[model samples]
Target: MSHEFTVETGLVAFSVGGRAQFGWLDLVTGSFHSEADGQCINDAIVAVEFSSDVVH
Candidate 1:
């Protein structure tokens, strides 16, 4: 029960565990930005990676 989306350009937005998150991949700068709680950036990325529509 996973959800996937294709983003060609601009910003990609989503939510996880009632928390709002935003991500953007900058090809020019070779940098990525994700906004979420805590200082652990990996947590945000992981949350987006393993996200699903079905409740577990």
Candidate 2:
């Protein structure tokens, strides 16, 4: 299904997937779909990881 998190500052949302990739995101500027393959998608990142990194 879906999950939602509430922190002191703001809220966070997550969409779990059977596969490594999953997302159903909508933005005010535009909307798009995203995915992850459980692999290194970029080299610019270091010592930091995100469960879902969505780009719209």
Which regions of candidate 2 fall more than 4 Å away from where they truly are? Answer: 1-21, 37-56
Clash totals, every prediction: 0, 0
Candidates in order have lDDT scores of 0.40, 0.28
TM for every model, in the order presented, reads 0.25, 0.18
On TM-score, the candidate that comes out on top is 1
**Tens-digit lDDT string for candidate 2 (3-56):** 553212211223233222232233332222333322222221112123435644
RMSD to truth, every model: 10.9, 13.9
Please write out the lDDT profile of model 1 over residues 1-56, one tens digit for every residue: 39544323333334444444555544455444563421223333322333436643
